[model samples]
Structures are given as C-alpha cells and as structure tokens.
Target: MIRAITGLLSGIVFGFGLALSGMMNPARVRGFLDLFGQWDPTLAFVMGGAILAMALAWLFQAQTDKPACASQYHLPDTKHIDGRLIGGAALFGIGWGLGGLCPGPGIASLATQFVPALIFVASMLLGMTFFRLWNRG
Candidate 1:
C-alpha cells in the first residue's frame, strides 16, 4: 500500500512537472528535438536538471544505511548491446522525432484534447504488445 501510494504521488508529481515544463506540448518537444536543424536546445536544460537530480539521489543513497525503499537496488547486468538494442533505439528515435512524444510526457499529455496524443498512446501500447508477441514467438 505504501509503495502504491508513493508511486501514485510520484507519477502525479512527474505529470505535473511535464505540464509545467511545456513538455506536454508536442511542438515544444519537437523544437527541442530539432537541435541539429534549427538548433533549439531547451531540452538540454531539462536533461541536465535530471542528471543533477539523479546525482543528488545517488549521493543520498550512498550516505544512507540502505536504499530509500524497503527493497534492495537491482541494476541491470546485461552487457551486450547487440542488434536488438540498436534496432529498438533506432525505432524509438524515429518514433519520437515523427510523433514528437516519448512515453512519460506522451501519456501525461493524454489529459489534453489532442488527437495525435491519443493516437500516440494507442500506437505505443500496440507496439509494446507487438514486441511482447514477437519475443514470445
């Protein structure tokens, strides 16, 4: 129950931040992504802030007796960055550039009356389902 409540609160806060940051606006995100072309680099500040936040979290965790949660931290050990990872990243890049939406802000933007956002969410779920099926086969 505690974890669920915490997760809900965290998601709300994240969504609020997205809305506040203009990340929910596809145009803003597309502009941010188009640094190579028009050279809009507003997203860099957002990313830098996130990196700083993660660093602070890591510093806190290192000082603490244990992880902030009741569970142990589980980091991935998969060292191989093979074809699958590359292919997936390329697909994600294309989707993000074309659709102007990544998962978090994409889902958070569903509250707004944007047909493209809705379509993005639906297609994202479909893609996830397709990958699950493809991997299971």
Candidate 2:
C-alpha cells in the first residue's frame, strides 16, 4: 500500500513537472532537438535538473540500507553495453527525433486528449508488444 501510494504520488509530481516544463508539447521537444536551426535550450536545463536530482538521490540511497517503502533497492545490474543495447538506444533516439515525444512526455500529453499523443502511445505499445513476441521466439 505504501509503495503504491508513493509510486502514484511520484508519478503525479513527475507528470506535473513535465507539463510545467513545456515538455508535454511535442513542438517544444522538436525545437530542442533542432540544433543548427531554431534550437531551444530550455530542455537542456530540465535534463540537467533531473540529472542533478537523480545524482543527489543516488548519493542519499548509498547511505541507506533500504528504501523507505521497499525491502531492497532494485538497481540495474548491467554494466557492459552490448550491440543490443546500442541498437535499442539508436532506435529510441530515432523515434524521439522523429516523433518529438518519448514515453514519459507522450503519456503526460495524453491528459489533453491529443490525437498525436494517443497515436504515438499506441505505436509505442505496439512496438513493445512486438519486442516481447520477438524475444519469446
């Protein structure tokens, strides 16, 4: 119950932040990616702030034995990057560049009932389903 509540609250905060930062707008995201053109640096500040916050959280986590709501900290174990990781990252970058909406902002944008965001999210889900089926084969 505590975990669920905390997760919900955190997601609410994150979504609110995304909306407030203009990240929920696909045009703003595309503008940020338009380097050498009319590039916007606002997203960079948002990214930097997120990175700083995560770094601080990591530092704090290292000092604790367990999370307040969980018994153990679930961190990624993979240290070495392989071809699959690189390829997936490339795909993600290509998708973001083309659509101007990654998963987080895309989902957040759904609150406005934007058709493009709905289509993007549907395509994302389809891609995930395809990946799952491919991996099982």
Candidate 3:
C-alpha cells in the first residue's frame, strides 16, 4: 500500500512538474532541440533542475540504509554500454526529434493534447512491443 501510494504521489508530482515546465508542449521541446535555429533554452533549465533534484536525492540516498517505503534500493546493475544501448538511444533521439514528445511528457500531455498524446503513447507502446518480440530468445 505504501509503495503504491508513493508511486502515485511521485507520478502526480512529476506530471505536474512537466506540465508546469512547459514540457507538455511539443513546440517547446522542438524549439529547445533547434540549436542552430530559433533555439529555446527552457528545456535545458528544466533538465538542469531535474538533475539537481536527483543529485540531492542521491545524497539523501547515500545517508540512508534503505528506502523509506521499500526494503532496499533497486538500482540499475548495467554499467557497460553496448550496441543495444547505442541503438536504443539513437531511436529515442529520432523519436523525440520527430515527435517532440518522450514517454513522460507524452503521457502527461494527454489531458491537454489528447489526440496527439494518444498517438504518441500508442506508437511508443507499439515500439516497446516490437522490441520485446524481437528480443524474445
């Protein structure tokens, strides 16, 4: 119950932050990507703020034995990057540039831009499904 509630609350806060930061707008993200053109630095500021928050979280985590709502920290074990990582990153960048929406903002923008958000989410899910099927060994 605690874990579920924590997840819900965290998601709410994250979604609210995304909406507040103008990240829900595709134009804002695309503008940020336009470095040589009419570039916008708003996304950079938002990303910087997020990174700072995570850094503080990491500092707090280091002082704690375990998570407040969980038994232990579930950290990623993968340290070495391979072809899969590079390919996935390239695909993600392509999708982000073409659609101007990644998973978080794509989902968060559903309330504002229902159709576009739905399309993006559907396509994302489809891609995930394809990847899963392709890697099923």
Candidate 4:
C-alpha cells in the first residue's frame, strides 16, 4: 500500500511538472526538436533539471541499502548495447519526431482530452502490446 501510494504521488508530481513545463503540448515538443528552424531550448532546461535531480537522488540512494518504501532497489541490470535496445530507441525517436509526444508527456496530455494525444497514447499502447506478444512468441 505504501509503495502504491508513493508511486501515485510521484506520478502526480511528475505529471504536474510536465504540464507546468509546457511539455504536455505537442507543439512545444516539436519546437524543441526543430533544430534547423525555430528551435525552442526550454525543454533542454527541463531535461537538465531532471538530470540534476536524478543525480542527487542517486547520490542519496548510494548511501542506502534499500529504498525506504520498497524491499529492494529494482535497477536495470543490462549494460551492453544490443539490437533490442537500438531498435527500441529508433522506434521511440521516430514516434517522437512524428507525433512530438513520448510516453510520459503523452499520458499527461490525456488530461486535456485532446484527440491527437488520445490517438498517440492509443498507438503507444498498441505498440507495447505488440512488443509483448512478439517477445512471448
């Protein structure tokens, strides 16, 4: 129960931050991605802030054996670059370039009931479903 509560609270804070940072807007995301044209650097600052916060959190986490709200720290074990990683990253970049919305911001934008966001989120779900099925086969 505590884990779930903390997860929910963290998600709420993250979504609020995304909304406040204008990342929930597809246009703003596309603008950030636009390099040769009118590129917006606001998202870079947001990303920088997030990186700094995560670095600080990691520094704190290094001092602990386990998380306060969990039995153990669940971290990624893979360290090698492989085909699956490259393919997934390529897919993510393509989707982001096409729709200007990644998973986090895409879900956050759902609060607005925007049709494009809805379509993007639905497509993302479908892609995840297909990946799971393919992996299980």
Q: Tens digit of lDDT per residue, candidate 3, span 1-108?
A: 988999999999999999999999999989998999999999999989989999999999999999999889999897999998999899899889889999999999
- TM for every model, in the order presented, reads 0.87, 0.96, 0.96, 0.94
Cα error, candidate 3, residue 61 (Å) = 1.1
State the lDDT of candidate 4 residue by residue for 29-87, as single tens digits. Answer: 78988999999998899999999999999998999999999889999887999998999
Worst 10 residues of 1 by lDDT: 66-75
Clashing pairs in 2: none
For model 2, residues 1-137, the per-residue Cα lDDT tens digits are: 98899999999999999999998887887899889999999899999999999999999999999999989999999799999999999999999988988999999889885798899999999999999999996
Please give the distance, in angstroms, between residue 63's alpha carbon in candidate 3 and its true position after superposition. 1.0
TM-score between candidate 4 and the true structure: 0.94
Better of 1 and 4 by lDDT: 4
Error of 3 at 83 (Å): 1.0
lDDT of candidate 4? 0.90
Superposition TM-score, candidate 2 onto the true structure? 0.96
lDDT of each: 0.83, 0.93, 0.94, 0.90
**Which runs in model 4 stand beyond 4 Å of their true positions?**
none
- Count: clashes, candidate 1: 0
Model 3 bad stretches (over 4 Å): none
